[model samples]
Structure formats: C-alpha cells, structure tokens
Target: MGVHSVNWEPFLTCAVTGAGDTLSKHPDLPVTPEQIATAAIEAAEAGAAIVHIHVREPATGKGCREVAYYREVVERIRDSGVEVLINLTTGMGGDVVVGDRGGEDTPAPGSDFVGAMERLVHVEQLRPDLCSLDCGSLNFDDDRLVYVMPPAYLRPSAARIRELGVKPEMEVFDLGHVAFASRLVAEGLVEPPALFQLCLGISYGAPSTPAAMVAMRDHLPEGAVWSAFGLGRMEMPMVAQAMLLGGNLRVGLEDNLWLRRGVLASNADLVRRAKAIVEDLGGRLASPKEAADRLGLPPA
Candidate 1:
C-alpha cells in the first residue's frame, strides 16, 4: 500500500524512554522511574494512545533490566489514572559483544546475553498491555556489538509472552527480520493479526525512506497490524510515510532527540508533531480504547 491506501484512523505511540545511552546527549532525558512516569503521562496527554517504557538506573542513567524499576514505573503510571495503554520493552539482555575478530568464540566482557525467560522477567512481573518482541539479531549500530535474538530463543519467548496474556509487538529492523516474524506467526506463536513495529534507520538496517517503509509494509504477513518509525532526522518523515502507507505511527525521544536541528525535544513534543502531520493528511488519531480494540489488547 502507498498513498493510495492511507490509514485513515491510526494510533500513535510514544516511546517515553529507551534503553539507549542517550543521557549525555540529552540532559533532560527521563532517568528515574518518577521522571519516566511523568513523561509517559505528558506524552499521553499530548496525543499518544500508548506509551512505550524502558527503565533506567536512577543514579547512572543507564538502562537496567531490574524488575524493581519496571514495577515502580508501572505503579506510578497506574496511580496517575492516565488512560493510556502501557507498552514495556523486552529488547534488553540480548547484546552479544565480541572482542577480537580472530578467535573469540566466547562472549566478550560487555555481552549481556541471557536465556529467553530471563529477558522477560520484567514483562512477566508487570504484565503490561504490550511488550516488544525483537524478531531477529542485528549489528546494533556498532561494529563490536550485535543484538542477538535467534529463532531458538524467539520461539519460546513468543509462547511465554502469549501465556502471560500480553500482546507482543513484534519489532522488525530489517526485511529478513520480517520474514522470520512471518514464520513465527505461521507457527501460531503470535496471535491472529499479529502486531509489528518496523524499526528503520538503525545501523546496518533498513534505511528510513519511503521506499523502505513501502517495502516492509508490502512484506508484512497478511492482516498484520504494523507501525513504523525512523531514527534521528527521519523520525518525523516516517510518521507521514507510515501513515500514508496504511500503518500506524510512533515517535519519541527513544528514536530522535531533536525537534529540529539544534532544539532538543521531549516525548510529548514529538507526539504532538506527529499528531499534527496525521491530521494534516486527513487522518484521525485513534484513542487508547480504540487502539486497544484494534490490537486485541485489554483495556489500560
């Protein structure tokens, strides 16, 4: 589908915070659970139907996979009485950093690889409305680090995530990843009308362009509900591209820090901008309840 088949009513998601090391780049990036929750609330108010969450170490500002941090963030969001759906990330604990190029079969010192179940500890405990299921491994924006998620790990993780009654937003960074995700859906691991998030513009992944978004959308499994986002400067452009291609929209500090060339943006700022683009294109923003129904998720 292309501009001829635009998604007239699309839901918007705000990745309130990500697991990336963006603290030094943006001083106001949400670090503590309190700050993250506040950001989520603000993003929801600005027009996000769903808020994607990733917890960080309060003191160091580095992402951590602790259940305590996840729990606190979830609890705070719940207490605020916001009507936005929560989408927690399960993309952590899959890094495999190799040291030397010659003879290093063993994982390097910075590797954080763990079993599938171990990575979902937070999702299993918090049971958010949605959680990411990174479909395949990729060179994680750096030569030395590769985010590893082979089928051996993904099959079991998909089953467990289904058992927990939470929707898994299959995250596809490349075309091959989309094929593997289709295989998982064929195996009945992902529920009917499986959800996908096309991650564009990361290193060694699909570029953030209209052609790339159209290619990924064409390759998606039949009846799959998908959204797409670009990194850095491509973030806003993909918003219009994805919406025009019959897909949903996503924008946040997690993907791009700049509202413009030199101005830093909060999650809410990005969401508001995306909302305007959607409206300008004659598209209606879906409410949280509407998005939940479309994705087959329980109410937030």
Candidate 2:
C-alpha cells in the first residue's frame, strides 16, 4: 500500500474569555460585547465547532452578573451567522467565599449570593444551545475563589436547564464531580447521553496529566459526550490527550494566554492551532452542525 491514513474526527470548542484573572493579565482580552462577539465569530470561521463564552463588563473587565450583558453577547453572535454552537457558562453563581473570623456572621461580599434559578436565568432567556453547569465545588486558586455547587443547588440548576430546553454541559473538575454528575443523570435531572466538560490543571483539583484524564474519562456516564481542557501550559497538550482518550477538545484565551511564549493569543488563533494539532494527529475537525448533533444541541 502506498499510503493510508487513520481518520480521527473530534469537535473543537473555543472558550473565548474566562471569568478569571484576565483583567490585568492580558491587554487584549475581549471585554466588551462587540469584542466578545467578534472574537467568537472569528473563532467559528477559524474552525471552532462551539464558542464557549463568559461575559465581562467592558468598563471594568470584572465578571458581571448582569443578564443584559449576556443578552447582548448572544444576540450579536446569533446575528453574525457564525454557524457555531453557543455554550454560555452557568458556572457563575456557584462561587462561594467565606469571610475571616466571625465573618460567617457577615455575608462575604459577593459570595454565595445567587440561587440556582437565578444562575440559569440568562441561559433560559438567551436559550443558548448549551451551557456549562459545574458539577461540584472546589477550592480554586490564589484568586481565593471558592467554587461551591452543593447538591441542593445543582438539583434545581439541572431542572431549570431541562425546563428551558437547554442542554447542561456538566463541568467535571475532579473525580467526585464525575460521580455527582452521574447521580444527576440517575435522578432524571440530566437527560441521557449527558454532556460533560472535563476541566483539568486548575489548581487544587484534578491534575492535568494523562492518568487524570483517563480516570475521569473512565468515570464519565456511558456514551456521554465530553470535552476536556487543561489550564496554563498543559491546555493544548490536553486537547491531544483528550482526543487519544476518545473525547472532544476545548481551547482559547480563557485557559491559556500565549500563542507561544511571550506572544499573546486570540480566540481564533487558539482554534487554528487546535485544528492543526488535531489534523496532524490524523483527526478531522467537526463542523458546528456536527458538533451540535454530537452533543444533542440545536444546530446552528
């Protein structure tokens, strides 16, 4: 035989800008609605099956809970004809921060505030095909963000997501989160062929290593549609790792800052790089429609 090639087609998602430490870190992090939409549309054109988004105020670059911001971003994306699955993050309200001594008495500023329904309100209104529902809570990084998702909270969040006809893309940060997600499926809260995002390399949670990815992948619900991401340097490596383990991949300025060392990156650039890696490994890129079908979402 002269030449034969293996075909491995995996969907790619571009997480535009995450809701963490981006304020002072990157000068070009998309903060305005126009910026977010432009970046997302460009990423779609660059071969992102999905555009995972988190909205921040243009003036402050700080994470905002205003539903209007989400509305503007979603509307812009829809009008732009990018043909990419929209995956807005519902992982916002789950943040919990405890106060200093005797501070439990005093509610920590902006900690553990919004309820489950409130968290999914934007998703309900915007009706993005998919939204991230963080499976559980964990101690976040030096940012001192305490990510908290109690069962009491997640149950309602899942129910709300179902009611709105929006898919809950369960975010599994650790092994326990995987178990919790399965329980949600068992409880009939989350629908069949559950969608999941295996978040790795974030501090104090699962390490971004092959062993960790395998463990989490094995624990996921059978036939579950899943994507994986590694933060910082391991972000792109985990894309290939997730593919080897038979899963999809996600990348963007959210998880990583550089196209290479000392060079700032863009959402489109991340997707382009991810495309090259997947293709080099003999994996084909999935289109937005294909990705939507794979994840049981309404096609773009």
Candidate 3:
C-alpha cells in the first residue's frame, strides 16, 4: 500500500459529544440520547461520514458509561437510515483524580477507574463499527486530573474488541503513545491496517503544530490509517493539515465548542465548516460507504 500517497478524497468524522466537562460551557451541547442522535444525523447530512460518540448522564449532563444511553443513541441513528458509521468511545471510565496532597491513597471524588471489561460493555452489546482504544495515559489537563490507560489495560481491551469483530481506533496522544500502539500491532493484538487518531494540543501532550503532526504521522506503522485533530482554534486548521498530510480529519463539539470567537457551535456546524474547507482546498469529501471501504470497515 502507498501509505504516503496524497489523499485527494478525505473523510470527515464529527465527534458529536465528547466525554469532557463542556456541558456548562456550551449551551447547546447534546446531553440526551435523542439530542445526541439528532446531532449525529445532522452531522452526517452535513458531510460527516462517521460520528464519534460519547454518552453523557441525561440528568446531570456529566459523562457516563450507561449502556442504555448508548443503545438509545445508536438505535436512533441506525433507525434514521443516515448511512453514517458509529465509533463509540471506550476511553471513558479510566479517569483518575488525585486527592489531597497528603492523602495519596485516596482518589478524588470524580475519579472513576474500572477494569477493561466494564469499559467495553457498550461496545460488546451494541457492536458499533468502531471503538476507541486510548493508547496510554497522561495528565489530562493538569496535575490533579489524569487519564489512565496502561498497556495491560489496553491489550485486553484490544483483544476483546477484536473478538467482537469491531475495529479499534487507537487514540495516540503523544509519540510514546504511538510507540505503545505500534507494540500492540507488533504483538498482533491490534488487527492489520491499524487505525490511529493522533490527538494533539491537549494539556501536557503533543502540541498542535504542523511539525508535531508530521512527526506523529511519520511514526505510524506501514499500512496504518491515521487521522488527527486539534482542540479549540486549532480545529479547522488541523482539519486542512491532516488532509494535506494524507489522512482524514475530525471535528465536533467534543474537541471544539466554537464556530468563531463568542459563537457557540453545534456538531453539524463544525462538520459543515470542515467540509467547506476540505472542498475549497480541492479535496473531495468521502461518503460513509467510501470511508468504510478506505478504512477496511464493513458497510454500515
């Protein structure tokens, strides 16, 4: 396969609702199952071939791992006949918050660490087209908040995802994380044509820059399909950059919450803007079926 060949056709992924603390920040963030499904469908209609989903607690709007929420969201999307691929988030349930400085043994109130099996419950039950497997852990935003994904945890999670006949989208936050994912592929834990999402511009991780993105892209294993995204203002810029680098692009309220300064964005708006940028640059947007074929995914 010509890994570095220019990708004149790009696929867009709209991350409908991320498992972040953005409910209060964005007034229109999709919290309920119905709302989330609507947003996903709208995004697909606006040129998103895939929708990366993360369910939140309907009442409190906090991120949760409730299988019912995922079921409802998936059912609505599938029932709508939108022809979009589903990529569920298995990266939740691994958050760890450090408690008082002196009380190292005690985890903070928000910490919710669980085994791999618990994280995969929705993926196993719903059997989405793809599920994310975070490659490694790091301090999410600051010293107090950390996201944990050790190799021991990832191996079993990857194995289970494979057994379920679902594709695992390895989320790599840094160079080391990419190396670890390569190890998983080398060990045959991750299936061939490994998929990776290069996550950049988050706190304490790789910066969102052209140089950094190219570095990560260069490190990807041969025949591996990769995509990259940056948070906040870097979102649209990275969309073009990732496509120019011969990879796909992602956008939504999950990574960014604004269409412009002082303007809030819905998932559909983000996807539309990204679509416009992709097309304006002489790149064709891939439909759901086209994206699936390129990624070696079965039709939706």
Candidate 4:
C-alpha cells in the first residue's frame, strides 16, 4: 500500500490498555484475563478492526511480560468469536535505564533486559497476525527510562518477525526512526511493503501536531502501509487528521482513557467514537477484512 495513489478509508485500531499504570489511572481498565478478552470483543463489535494488546499481571495491575498470560488472552479472544486482528506488543522487553554517576547509583530501573530473540519469544510462540516493533528507542515514560531498540537489536527481531509470518508494525516517533526502518527493509531484515505506525504525542519524544504529523507521514518509504496516533487531547483530532491525510487511525486507553473529560472510556467506546468521527468527516471506516487486506494480514 503506497502512501499515495490509493483510495484509502481509515482503518481503526483500538490500543485497549498498554503495559502501563492502569489500576490507579482508570477504574474500568481491563486487568484480568476475562476483563481483557471482554474488552477486546467489545472493541471489535464497536468497529475496531484490530486490538493492540498489552497483557497485565492478574493480581497486580503491573504490566506482565509472561508468555502464559498472553497465551491465555489469545485463547479467550479466539473463543469469544470476535473477528478483529490481534496485534501483540513485542515492545515490553526492551527498556534500559542507567543510574547517575555510573555504578555508584542503584541502576535506575531498566526494562531493557532481553535481546531481539527474547523479545520476539512470545510472538513466535503465539504468532499474532500483527506485532509491534518499536523501531528505535526514545526516553519513554516519566522519570528517566529509555525504551531501547537499537538497530543491532532490531535486525534479529525483525528477522524473527518475518520467520513467524507476523506483520511488524514499525512504530516511528520521529523522522530518523522512519529512515532507520527503511534501512531495515533495505537490509532485508524487514520485508517489502512494510507496515508502520507513526506514534505521536509522547513525553520528550515528539509533540502531537498536524504539521509534524504530515511531515512524518510524507517521509514513510514507498509502498508502506502506516497508521498514526496522538496522545491525550490530540487523540480524537489525530484520528480525523490521519484519515484526511490518507493514513490509518489508532486509538484506545493506551494513549488516553477518556471518551471526554471525566468520562471513563472502554475499548468499545473508543472504537465507536472513532467510527463516528470518520463518518462525520465523510470518510468510512474499514472492516476487519478490509483492514487485513490493507495491512497484508491474513483473512479472518
């Protein structure tokens, strides 16, 4: 799918809950396996073609990197009869933080523990139709931690992704990440007609704005299918913005937990609202089959 010269309808994906704070932030956010599966089904019913999942610990709301949890979640979603595509996160394992004054400080809490193979382990085991490969590292989360995905790390991960036959959503926060992703494709680590997700409005990486969105979208490699999202207040607006610009739209509690101020949002609510937004703007939203075709995902 080229960035241009194609008749594009905005394909919506609900990012449900990311691997971040949920117990304190939103009361309705899905934590248990049952909750997660139900939320995903509701999102699919509400017109989200894909559900971007980040599993959590059943007891604590802490994000879990457990493969078993992911397997159970996938099972529940499959048995529930929802036709949406499952896009797992290969992003959680690669976080790195260094302490001040080298070894003197107590190693400022690093999430970057595993290499690409370890990062790709769950995906290889579960084999979701789509999985995210955070193209490069940035200073993610508040209070100094890095979500590191160096190219040396990415090459093997991308290769593993291809080996499993899962579509990799190359998440680019800036133009340089886009360039590096293209390099990955050229190096044959990533396959032709790659898929990308242009993540915007995160702390200390890139601001969510129209001009910046366009500039980054314009920079994607030819024949690549891409999606974009903005955090907080820009979330809904960026949905419409991405549609108008001929890219896909992504939304959910991962980026923001509100349908409006003080109104808690479920994954379904987010998807229903996005469906309405595109419709209001004289654009149509894609069905699961349409989205799968658009992103080269297998038929449902």
Candidate 5:
C-alpha cells in the first residue's frame, strides 16, 4: 500500500532512555530506575502511548543489563497507574569490542556478548507488553564497537519472546535487516502481523532522509505495523515523515538529545512537541488502548 492509502492515526512512542552514554551530554537525561520511571510517566501524560525503556547504572549512569533495575522501573510505572505500554530493550548484552592489534582473541573491557537466553532474562522476568529485538548486527556508531545479533541468535530470541507472550518490536537498521526480519516472519518465528521499527541515521546505517524512510517502509512485510525515527536533527523531521508514510512515531532523549540548538530536552518535551506536530497536521494521536489494539498488543 502507498503512504496515503494506509490508515494514519499516529501513535506516539517516547523512548524514555536508551543505552547510549549520553549522561554527560545532557544534564536531564534519566539514569536511575526512579528517574527513568518518572520520565516515562510524564511522557505518557504528555501524550505518548508507549514508552521505550532502558535501565542504567545509578552510580555511573551507564547502561547495564540488570533484572533488578528493570523490575524496579516496571513496578514503578505499573504502580503509578499510567496507561502507557511498556517496551523494554533487549538490545543490550550484544556489545562486542575488538581488542587492539596484539589482542586478537581478547575482547575489550566494554565488550559484552552473551547467549540469546541470557539476554532475555529481564524480558522473561518482567514480561512487558512489548520488547525490542535487534534484527541484525552492525558497526554501532564506531568501527571498534560491533553490535552482534546474528540470525542464529535472533531465531531463538524471537521464539523465546513469543513463548513469553511479549510482542517483539523488530528493530531494523538497514535493508538487509529488513530482509532477515522477513525470514523470521516466514519461518513463523515472529508472531503474525509483525511489528518493526526502522532505525536510521546512526554512524554507518541508512542515511536519515525522506527517500530512505520510504524505501525502508516499502521493504516491510505486507500488513506489518512499523515505526521509524532518526537521530540528532532528523529526529523531529522523521517523526513527521513516519506519520505521513503510514506509520507510528518515536521520540526521546535516546535518539536525540536536543529539542533545538542549545536546548536539552526531556522525554516529555519531545513527546509534547511531536504531539503538536501530529495534531497540527490533522492527524490524531493514539491513546494507549488504541495503540495496543493497532499493534496487536493485549489490553493493559
């Protein structure tokens, strides 16, 4: 279906905090579990139907894969009585840093590569309504840092997520990732009416542009639900582009740190701004209930 032919009630997703080391870049970035949960609640109140989450180390403000942190954040959001859908990140535990010239077998201090089952520990424990599954590996913004998500790893991870009854939001960074995701759908690994998130404008991924967004949208499986977002300045532009192209929207400090030049933004600020753009364009924002139905998620 072409962009205009598809339905266009935009559902906003506030990616509350990502695994990126942006603590130093922005003073208001949520680090601790309490902070992250508060930001998520505020974003939902500001018009986001879904909140993408990543837990960080409270001490150092670095992203870490700990179930305790995830539990705390999820509990807080649930206890707060917000209606937003929780989408946790399973994209961590895949960082692989190659050592210097002499240390071929030895990985760097930051390298963390574990099995598929180990990576999904938090998802299994918390059982969020949605969780992210990176479709393929790529040079994660730097040559030395590789994000490893081989097909062998993805098959089992997708299966496990399905078994846990959590919808996997397949994260596609490039055309090849989309193809692989299609394979997962074909193999019956991913649930029917597969969902995707087209991630653009990282260091070595697809360029963030209207043409690139359209091309990637075209590559998705038939009737698949998808959302797209870009990094840095392209964040808001892609928000509008995704809505125009018959998909949902995602915005947060995870993708872009600033609302404008010299202005650091909170997740709520980004969602509020995106809500305005969607409304001014004659597109209505989806509520949490509406979003769950559109994305094939069970009632919250």
Candidate 6:
C-alpha cells in the first residue's frame, strides 16, 4: 500500500450512540430516537459536520433494526433543521452468537443475523446523506460472538446503497476489511471518492496506535476520503493521530463514555474537544457544506 497524505482540512463525524451496551456505563447515553436526535443536534451545534447514528430499542436500550425508530430519528433531525450530514448505520443485524451444542440450537441467542437486503431496509427508506457499509466482519468482543458479513452479502448491499443515491461510508475495522472494501470499489459496486471509517481499538481488531492507523490509511484506495477513531482513552489520542496522519476523525459516546478519567462526556462535549484539537494542530474543521461538496453529496 502507498502512503496517503494527511487531510489538512478535515471533517468531524460524531457517532452519538452505537449499538454497544453503554447505557449503564454512561448515565446520559442516548436511548430513544428523541434523545438520539437531540444528541445529534447538539453534536452538530458543537461543530461536527456529520452525525453517525444507530437506533436502539427504546424500552431496552439495545440496538434494533426497526424502521419506525429510524424514521422517527430522521424526521426529528430534519425537522430541527440541523446542518450536519446524517449517516445512518447499516451495521446492525449481523451479530451472531454460537452455542456449545450443535445443530439448529447451536446458533444460540443474541444473534441478530439477517440477509444483505434486510440490513439496508432502513437506508433504502430514509435515504439519508450517508449510510455506513461495514466492509467486513470479525469476532466480536466475546469468543462465541461474531459479526458475519461475507462478500455475498456486501456486494449486493453496496449495489443497493448505490441505487438509493445515498453515499456509503465504508466502515473498516481492520486491514483485511480495507482490502475487501477496495475490491468492492474496484468492481464498481461503490462509486468514486469512496468514504471510509477506520474503526480501531475494538476488542479482537486493530489496536489504537499510530502504526495501525497509518497502516490502514496507507492501504486505503487511492483518492479515498477516510476518517479514524479509537475506543476508550485512546479516543482523544486517536483524534490527534488521525489528523496528524492526514485523515478526518470521529469522537463520541458511542466510541467512548468518558471525557476524562472519571467524568462522563456528552456527545457535544466530545465534538468540542475534537474541534479544539484540530484547531490547535493548525487544521481547520470543514463545514457541512464543505464536507458535502468534497464527499459529492447533495447540499442539505
């Protein structure tokens, strides 16, 4: 892979809430569509050009693939007239857990596996400015659990995402994931100037280190627009590393719960910190209009 230069003018993507079980860890973690929408607005007001979103089961706080929840969140954000670009997640419905016993029951519970088209249902309906396309799957946080997305599923999903006229932000967890995403782009399933998100520091994946970030960035397709994020304490450090490496960066409660050692952070708080870091480093934050034009999305 060739060395890719740094992005002097970078965009910030605040992932308000992810599918993880961070509710108990952070008291203010957004659960319902209303709260999630509110968090997105706050992040936007705090200088995030894009908001990466994942809906949860309102009553349980666990991530869900319900279109109603997504519709509510999208409607709320649009109604609020936030200038930030919306990037809905299609990373749900791919989690799988295995049982000790074999056969049909061996699949075990906590598995939300579904076909490719089923995962993109929400993206097709709302047709937001951007929707994430997890390029590959890997063993989740636990041993028995795995996120499954083979080429069979991704190819069709990418094709459908292209058809919807919504830009696909290819989320890559590791090096292999980046290679696979590049293949999709090579095959024309994804359009030019492909957007990528390097997810690091998750259990069983790439660590949140300069080497890992650079390796992933180096391997990205030529001329690809990309960003990087690390989980937990590494979140803030990765913010600097990503920018230094010439890429945009993401920071939010979804990837981290604390702004410091003990204090919890709101989505806006994280965005504010990231903005400050970018400015201090002599890098400018791109506005939503600037980001949209660079990423080839229609104006909001």
Candidate 2 Cα misplacement greater than 4 A, ranges = 1-7, 102-106, 110-112
User: lDDT of each prediction vs. the true structure?
Assistant: 0.92, 0.86, 0.92, 0.84, 0.91, 0.92
lDDT, candidate 6, 259-289, per-residue tens: 8888999999999999999898888899999
| TM-score for each predicted model, relative to the true structure | 0.97, 0.94, 0.97, 0.95, 0.97, 0.97
Tens-digit lDDT track of model 3 for 1-300: 344755778888899999888988988899999999999999999999999999999999999999999999999999998899999999888998887764766478888999989999999999999999999999997668889998889888888999999989999999999999999999999888899999989998999999999999999888888899999999999998999999999999999999999999999899989988988998888999998997788887
lDDT of 4 by residue, 158-274 (tens): 888998899888989888899899888888888867988989997876679989888888887777778899998799999988888878999998988888988988888888888
Residue 208, candidate 6: C-alpha displacement in angstroms: 0.5
lDDT of 5 by residue, 1-300 (tens): 554543358888899889888999998899999999999999999999999999999999999999999999999999999899999999989998887763765478788888889999999999999999999999986658989999889999999999999999999999999999989999999987798999999888888999998989898888898999999999999988998888899999999999899989999999989999888788888999998998788766
Candidate 4 Cα deviation (angstroms), residue 141? 3.8
Clashes in candidate 5: how many?
A: 0
Runs with alpha carbons beyond 4 Å of true place in candidate 5: 1-7, 102-105
lDDT of 3: 0.92
Backbone clashes in model 3, listed as residue pairs: none
RMSD (Cα, Å) of candidate 5?
Answer: 1.3
Error of 1 at 85 (Å): 0.9
Residue 160 lDDT, candidate 1, scale 0-100:
98
Specify the poorest-scoring 10-residue window by lDDT in model 4: 1-10
lDDT of 1 by residue, 82-153 (tens): 899999999889988887754556488767888999999999888999999999999986678889999999
Which residue pairs in candidate 4 collide? 95-111, 95-112
